[model samples]
Target: MKENIIALHQKNIAKGAEHLFLDKGFNLTSISDISETSGYSRRTIYKYFESKEEILYYLIIEGLDHLVQSIGDAIDSEQNFLKRYEAICACMLFYYENYAISAQSVNRFQSNAPLNMTTSVERIFALGVKINEYLSIWIEQGKEEGILKESLDVMPTVYILSTNLNALFELVTTKGTYLFASLHMTKEQFLSYGYTMNLNSLLKEPTK
Candidate 1:
């Protein structure tokens, strides 16, 4: 089925806003900047988004939607439960790598305008909360398969994993890849090493 006119317009405006954010960081980008990038007049932007804050929140929702779908695809493609964890890790990396331009939008919006995450935004992003659902399914499946520690406290553990993703990716995307490149290691090698390190912490010994 086709999306409604309002949703389609909001998506177009959000896509245009993303371009402006990429050219100039989110904090520096203004409504006029988006209007310039989108070729949509300021009046048109305001028709979909009341302010830059709403635009940032919309981008956050889009980011989360992408992440949850990536995780789902990863889980579906991997047969081994342990390998599925690695796939999920790769999915996380892909999200940041693909959408690095939006990090400032998410981080700054959460920091400077914390109160703007009201019930309306929550209702809007309620489905995007599937990131946790996918993680929970993986953890639960891993525990049953004896690939993850049965005693793993899924919530706190996943919370740490989820919360750290942005900072970790920022390090890699911003400078850590260069650190590895200087050592003659590719970004893939660096990411693989990081995944190994995560497994060493999260995975259980292969039971005979």
Candidate 2:
């Protein structure tokens, strides 16, 4: 009963913080804002979370959990390596579009290492490793099926795919409107081209 109450408080705090972070961004949102939004006093908030960054970390963990599950399900849904790859891409696009704040949390942490690392940070890193492992498994399966180039080094291929895909997602999230307007392209067109281009690079014979 005691544990359940604590979990409840933490959940409420996370919900409120996510809203404020989405509305005003992590850097701009304040503890006072979280307290007011959550209807929890400042003392109660502090008891639950040491800092605002910790709250953001909580959200990141939750988001990455969902992402991992989505990617796993996508891979399981398709026997064809190419189709599985496409499904993974679609899942990432959906995640970034709907969970913008969580996406931003990941990007921010990746670019800037936190000064004082905590257990939450460790978990975040572990989740990242898990994501890379999923990609590695997908690549290995593709190679075994003779779908991906036999000569492809798994880690390097995973690195390229992960890095480039993140870059593409970041570009769309940050500058999609401006870029699409200037290029006379829609977001769907841009992303479709990006996804296909990335997919083609790994095929034993590039897609025509």
Candidate 3:
């Protein structure tokens, strides 16, 4: 069918563009680069995607989909709040380790790119909200179970966890080598310690 063929072309274009974006980064990769890499004309590329940012937007969506699924699976696999929280942290590290380009693409889009307010952008924000909601649910469950501090405000706890986790991953991704050299700790060690500290901060201290 014609629609199927269009989908195929779009897939091909996105595949090629993903490679270029990973290799050269989103900001440096151009329409011409995408065209040449995809073996599609610039006009054809335009027919599928309105702009480079739109293409990046779709890639971010794909990445976030994988992340959300991983977190969901992690949560579903364990009933213990602390176990589930650790699993979620592991899932986040897995995402950054495996999907480095998509991870970087997300950072770049959020920090530097101007908001275009496309439907794709909306989807990206929705996925972000979904992620936050996941964290909020986990935090609330912990509080109910007496695993997390009862006084911890759910939204503020979510905000701190999300912001600090992102910062930790971004730091490890961008300056991992420097950190290793300066701090004498591997990226894995750093992240493990960071996650442990974050977890401890929320946990209710056992009654003596």
Candidate with the greatest lDDT versus the true structure: 2
Can you write out model 3's per-residue Cα lDDT over 1-208, one digit (the tens) per residue? 9999987887788888989988897889999999999999999999998888777777778788899888878766755777798789988888777766667766554466677787988887787778778888898888888888999999888878977888899888788899988999987788888888888888887421
lDDT against true structure, model 1: 0.73
lDDT of 2 by residue, 1-208 (tens): 9999998999899999998998898889999999999999999999999999899898888888888888888776755787888889987877777766777777665666555678998888888777778888998998898888888899888879977888999898889999999999999899888988998898888885
| Poorly placed runs, candidate 2 (over 4 Å) | 108-115, 181-185
Better of 1 and 3 by lDDT: 3
Model 1: per-residue Cα lDDT over 1-208, one tens digit each: 3458888888888898887777777789999988987788999999888888788777776776777788988777747876787778878877777765544544443345556566547744464456777788888887888878888998777766766665667767679856886878877777676666666666787321
Off by over 4 Å in 3: 1-5, 107-114, 181-184, 206-208
Cα lDDT computed for each candidate against the true fold:
0.73, 0.85, 0.82
Locate the minimum summed-lDDT window of 10 residues in model 2: 107-116
TM-score on alpha carbons, each prediction: 0.82, 0.87, 0.84
**Clash number for each model:** 0, 0, 0
Q: For this target, which candidate reaches the highest TM-score against the unseen true structure?
A: 2
Select the stronger candidate by lDDT from 2 and 3: 2
